[model samples]
Target: MTPANSDGCSPDFPDEALAAELDELRQLLDGTDKPACAEEGEGLVIMRLCSGLTLQEWEGLGARRDLRDWMALPITANPFPYLTRIQQTLKELVFLSEHDPLTKLHNRGAFERILSAELIRSSRSGQPLALVLLDLDNFKTVNDTYGHPCGDRVLETMGALLAAEKRTYDYAARVGGEEFALILPGVGMVRAEGIVERLIESARTLRVVCDGVDTPLCVTLSAGIACTKGKVAIGWEKLYAMADEALYAAKAAGKDRVRCAPIADLTGTPEKTLVRADEKRFLFTGTTKG
Candidate 1:
């Protein structure tokens, strides 16, 4: 994908520089290549996991929490066992409907619906969110090298990797035959790339064992990242295009690395949307330039 510039020059993305800066911050924050969850760090996580939930989904989560408390009751302690059992059955049915049978991640239909909801939520909250499009590199080769059964196993492993890596607020989905996506609410581009980079590190070491063989094989992935330009909400289609373009860049540049959408020029720009009241005062009261 060609990187877009403010002046319509070369396709060099504006936010390209932020990657290194965030990497440095990542180093300082964790002192390692690993990604940390919100509870593990002060910053660097999404705003909230339930930001984009519909009324029904929200109530479902509430019911889930309530059930967890009730689940702890002794077998003989619960007078009405039917109630918890019914809820559990409903939750299971919902899960089966919304999630892919293989990867156990959100299926394409569910993902698109959630994407729209998330964009709206991000817009209302006035915080940036990221959408990442990822494809397994040379996956056909892996399938050919092993077998279709092995290919399915690889897909399953990737699904697990995605689910394991993302925070509770983030969303993971299998959107295509081999294409997957991650929706990160309230996370900007810089932090988004950092998260995906750590995912890359983890995938680099993955070795899935196939049937009838002791030797395990590895897989590499290419990811493209796009963040909301600012508080202004763009359609999910546009956002996906930006991420798809970046994904093209990753594939063109070489597989197994992450690329990002063009960043809006944050330099010398007034902080209207994402700044605190005190920070806005600080911006207005900055040292006068000569």
Candidate 2:
């Protein structure tokens, strides 16, 4: 008795056995949504599932052989749904790895990697790169007086502002607790200072309201900026350190201000230039691009 469905094409088997075989085939195809390729070799049909799936992933699923053998069965099923699930999972994992869970900004690790890559690109292209470090003013007071939730809201607000205000190519990240970093590719000191000045002005206008607060909480941000030409000998680490020093200077001079490191230090010799919040002009007494 040849086992066959209404098409009458297989070994003579009962309907129950045919149904079970079809179920097994369906289960195998369910593993991935990619269009599986069927190849015939030595009287056996091998089905390969998932185009982008690596050998390691097949091993992890422990269903490589099962899928191959199941696809050999005389049954047809679509695997697109399974592939969609796998792709969605991969996207979520990658996002969680590279982004901060709190602020939804790039995490410190991602920012460091981006900065290093940008440094290499800048070196090759001979374009200037600028780094800006920002610290929240009296952030501790927000946490102490309002609570951690309120503090979180404030951070979220700052993160939103950065995302909205930064240029399309700018890389902004929440690099540390109450601290953020921005990488400006192809931007020099004067232009970088202008951007930071606008950021300072924007920070003043940010107001976050939380539960149990008498009034909306407005926080201030102090920034330290450092810029170097693309061909400069300085690396990302040195650039970040200089920006951090400038940020410290800003805090010392007065919170809610923007400070800039000396252009000479970045160019050749180390120098310091403090830009006050009330400064009318971004005076650069140092070297200019030729």
Candidate 3:
């Protein structure tokens, strides 16, 4: 009598007998060099043979004697080529989504995502974070005087400058046509301000050569610097607006300067007051109260 089959074994066989049969099959496959072939109706199954089976012995094990004639058929079931193309397309899409085409900097969308994540980490770890909004002074003049090409060059130069000055952990990107934003994680306002000052000086000293002559082009930048001192729900837009206002003040006073206003100072309502002194009437629009 045949032994009973074990769990999950074929129902036709008893356990000990099925185990012995499986062992015999395994030995037969292992002792053969060529794979065992089996044909069931229209499908062909190939089992990898191990060591010593010849073509004749393999053919003898086939379910149908005529299966040997179908052994030369090629396999056509792998989808790896199509999957590879899909993977490549996905990679290109990811790159385009995350990068700015103009300056090759991280795009605003990417910047916002990264900034949010960084802010959370900084808040949890009690680390300082600095944010700077930078605008090119009189950028319109550059475009008007030369051409759009010159304007593009200036932008590329500015992007390169930021890239050079940025630390490994810092995030610098072009957030607008004439505006750039920088995120300095773990940096305080004081240090951030110093970095901005250095950048301004660098921009002022940068010279562009055109038409075989060194064109004396001076670029001035107005920067607004802020830092996260404690846990707060302050949005990046608010910080950017504050910096922009400070930048406008710098331009109004004179171009080529860095103006930084504290978050507390930015909360007050701006008042419009006119001062008449001698023959001159000056309209001052600012949050400062005298």
Winning candidate number (TM-score):
2
Q: What tens-digit string does per-residue lDDT give for candidate 2 at 47-86? A: 4222233333433333423322222211233445445545
Tell me which of candidates 1 and 3 scores higher on lDDT: 1
All candidates' lDDT scores? 0.75, 0.76, 0.66
lDDT winner between candidates 2 and 3 = 2
User: Please, what are the lDDT tens digits per residue for candidate 3 over residues 148-228?
Assistant: 777888788888888998999899888888888898888877888899899999988887543323575667788877667
Q: Write down the TM-score for model 2.
A: 0.66
The residue ranges of model 3 lying beyond 4 angstroms of the native Cα positions read 1-89, 210-216, 263-290
Q: Candidate 1 or 3, higher TM-score?
A: 1
Give a tens-digit lDDT track for model 1, residues 175-231: 998899999988889999999999988989999888975789888889999887455
- Please report, as a residue range, the 10-residue window in candidate 1 with the lowest summed lDDT: 46-55
